[model samples]
Target: MIPDPDEQVLVDVRAPLREMIFPFLETIVITGVLWIVIGWFDAADAGRYGVGPLRLPPEWRNGFVYLWVMLVLWRFVLPLLRKRRRRMVVTDRRIIFRADGFRARPRTLAMSAVTWAEKERGLLAVYLQDSDLPVYYSGLPKIRKIARMINDPLI
Candidate 1:
């Protein structure tokens, strides 16, 4: 929905970095393993460790490693690219979360629905009256200031 004319945006920024941690870690681990395996094979191509007789063609092996690295790294790269398209906007009336450009409808949580806000496990957990569970957000550069805004009644 289009925002109400009276609603004023308080904060407009990217989504939390919490969502990115796992994808990057997984990509790094897989790519590192691939590099190690390729290095082992390349050692033979370099005529090292008496495995010179087992050396395969260097060109194909290099190409294979490059392709594999790109494939594995894409997992992390795609998310990083898409994350730039998403944003979190905090307004006086509500909080609007735009997940990506392709999503026509954004998710929003009304400020009036919020019962309280607290920090938990490096995240800001906002408790809502309509739900039993709290919605969490992180990655704000000024954590304390945002927490204060969330908890402030006059905000």
Candidate 2:
């Protein structure tokens, strides 16, 4: 978590969210590479091999090409085009989330809206995210204060 300009806390939701990124990229990259390589092999073995019949005709290259294009585009290009605009700010009264990349809304969640929060130090939970949900902090240096604040009686 990083401190905001007015000293309000910023708890990045990215850490847990980050767990999904690499695996997703790896899947896409591996699948894309494998498919493209298979397509290339099939194209090369057009007459002599038995696999050519299993592949789409060369005329369908456009479709496979388009699929790979979209995969690569979504995997790499889209994010660059979509501005990275996610901010999770925790203030005295509320938690504000602003995301402008895929979605175009700046949402704000009031502290009172936080129905529940708990900490889990179990091994599974620790490696999965090092935190629990409905979590309010994300490595935001002052975890104790935030936990105490959220669990505070005043609300």
Candidate 3:
């Protein structure tokens, strides 16, 4: 929905640190493993190309490590950075999420489109909170108030 210029913003929610924690941890672990694998490959000679143990040149191994790191950065770190920029603004008529960066797209949900709203909690709730419609917020202060603002028609 095209928001009215006069529409008043009721809530502005930023993606919280808790929302980034899992992806950050995942990136760290995967990158660490890739580094270890690259190191191992550099240190050991492995059978390859139907021949006995073969050792790749140090440059080739280094190149592979560099490529892997780049891949990880693109696949994980870049998205994490973009996610950090995510913000959800709830206006009188609609909810707008501005996700700016790689593959970025703004998402707008008309308040009229929202059929239901509820506060969620539990182990996985923090991660799940951002994806549901109307408002994208997780581990945020006054989340209950935000939910109420979204759900109450009189608001």
TM-score of each: 0.58, 0.43, 0.52
Tell me the tens digit of each residue's lDDT in model 1 across 1-155: 45678987676777567778988788878778878778878888788988888867778678768877677667777777676656666678887766654553678998999888777777768899989999877554455556667677365
Ranking by TM-score: 1, 3, 2
Worst 10 residues of 3 by lDDT: 122-131
lDDT per residue as tens, model 2, 12-82: 44223443476467657767785876567566557534564565556566566666667766765565444
User: In model 2, where do residues sit more than 4 Å from their true spots?
Assistant: 1-4, 18-46, 50-58, 72-87, 98-101, 109-149, 152-155
Q: Report the C-alpha displacement of residue 7, candidate 1, in angstroms.
A: 4.1
In each prediction, how many residue pairs overlap at the backbone (N, C-alpha, C within less than 3 A)? 0, 2, 0
lDDT accuracy of residue 120 in candidate 1:
78
CA lDDT of every candidate: 0.73, 0.51, 0.65
Error of 3 at 36 (Å): 3.8
Which has the higher lDDT value, candidate number 1 or candidate number 2?
Answer: 1
For each of the candidates, the C-alpha root-mean-square deviation to the true structure, in angstroms, is 4.5, 8.5, 7.9
Highest TM-score among the candidates is held by which one?
A: 1
Model 1, residue 50: C-alpha shift (Å): 2.8
lDDT of 3 by residue, 26-134 (tens): 7788778878777667556565334346666677777877877787787777766876776767788887766655565668777766755666762112122335533
lDDT of 1 at 118: 74
